[model samples]
Target: MFTGLIENLGVIDSFESDRFTLSVLNTSTTSILSTASVGDSIAVDGVCLTVESFTDNSFTVTVSPETLQRTTLSEKIKTTNYVNLESSLCVGSKLGGHFVTGHVDGIGSLVNYISTNKAWEMTFAAPSSKIQEWSNFIEPYLITKGSIAVNGISLTIAECDVSGNWFKVSVIPHTYAYTNLHYLRPGDLVNIEGDILGKYVEKFLSSTLKSTKDRQSNINSDFLAEQGYQ
Candidate 1:
């Protein structure tokens, strides 16, 4: 679990078929390498990648094909300079942002970005159809004021299209300057993870209702007579 608060910027040193290495590129927060150890979970662009090995200024993780297919990590290897990095939430740590599982549901793209006095209004076009190439899951449950993670950065939805094709977020200057969102272009794809809480609730309710209907007992006249209720 993570709070979606970016801790540092990691410059990708190398990306291969299964391995990804990055340096401890920090801007404001404490460098993760200061305390991170092997097997520690790190959110690299919204995907929870376990640290396979490390050095004073660098760390590595072995990525799976499924993760590569679902996140922007592969696309970013050829484009993005720095990737957003965040440490997992601790027991007593501050929860500045929403709960981010670091599980990328699908990839979305930037539709537009505009500067505003209050905040930078940024819009993203979500994947509409299930692209089997990816995890093939694009269920947008984002409500107005609900939280969403884009490239591992938790943000609140400002305006979402009813069709779930796109949504907007108002990012403050601090957030914009610190994370990899600054490196995004209009068409750049981002790792997207919907709020886990909402997803679970939706699943629970749907399953509960389905099971209830499946187990419905029909009380016909013949059944009532057999039960001595006629």
Candidate 2:
């Protein structure tokens, strides 16, 4: 699991079919490489990818067909791109951000970005035509005032509309300057992972509760049979 806390900004060095070569830039270079290794999982722009190879300055990983279909990685690679990279969390480390599974639900287009003295308020539009397919990742994860991981950076869901396929997030200047979020354009695609906790809660409430209810009903039926009631 990841914390949606970006540790390094890695550039796309090269791409060959489904495989991508990345080079870590900036001062975190050594620290970022230290914890990383072949076969280790890393979140690249909120998409959990396994390292296939690595060196002091660079690494390579293969993107699965499902990943390509669900995330913005394929879109970002059409040109040179910088991705937010975060290594998997270690035991005892502070949970700086919410639980992020590095699982991209679907892609969204950045519709607008407004800069103010305080922060950057950005709006995104999920495809409206295919509501279910477009919002599948976010629908389960969104809660008012709760956290969501966008491009591997954890941010709270400031607001969402019940019917509209759009939401807004307010980004502080520090996050904008440190992460690749600053390089985002109005039309850029983003890999979004809804909060992990929300997903688990939903699963438990939906499946586990149903199972418990069914078992209780069966028990009640057995009790009635023992009492000679049909």
Candidate 3:
């Protein structure tokens, strides 16, 4: 689990097949190397990846084929890209941001960016979420003023289309400058994770409704026996 708060900006070192290596650019290398161990989970751009190896300045993780198909990491690997990094949440620490699972649901495209006097209002167009898939579940939980994790940065949805495929977020200058959002361009893809709480509620409601419908339509032998019905 994570808090959606970025801890460091890492320079993409190399992506050779399954090996994804990154080096600390602005953050302290010695501190990270000393603390982080192999098998520790790290969130790279909202994707939870396990640390396979590390050095004073760089670390490597193995990316699964599923991750490559679901996230923007494959694209990030093509060029020299800076990715947002956040360590797993520690117990007893302040929850600065909403609970983030570092599980990318799917990819979203930046549609537009408008600079307001106080913040940056950005619009994104997520793919249609008719079924449950990463990047395909946004519609169920894309609520206005609800939390979302985009590229591992926690943000609140300022507005959302009723269809749920498009949404807007308000980004303060501090958030824009500190994280990788500053490097974003229109049409660029980003990893997205909706609020977990919303997902849970959606699942619960769906299950309850389905169960009710099934019970109404089908006769259950156990239920009939309990009710003394032949």
Between the candidate structures 1 and 3, which one is better when assessed by TM-score? 1
Number of backbone clashes in candidate 1: 0
Q: Which candidate is the best by lDDT?
A: 3
Off by over 4 Å in 1: 127-136, 220-230
1 or 3: which has the higher lDDT?
3
Lowest summed lDDT over 10 consecutive residues: which window, candidate 1? 127-136
Ranking according to lDDT, highest score first: 3, 1, 2
Residues 1-230, candidate 1, lDDT per residue (tens digit)? 99989999888888877998898775864788888988899999889999999998899999999888767788767863788898888899999999999988888878799988868899987544434422335444767899999889989999887766678999999999999898887977888888898888888998999999899687888899999995
TM-score of 3: 0.88
Residue-by-residue lDDT tens digits, candidate 3, 36-154? 98999889999999999898778999999999988989989887878988888889988999999988888888989999999999998864432355335777789999999999999
lDDT of each: 0.84, 0.82, 0.86
Ranking by TM-score: 1, 3, 2
Please state the error at residue 132 of candidate 2 in Å: 3.2
Candidate 2 vs candidate 3: the TM-score winner is: 3
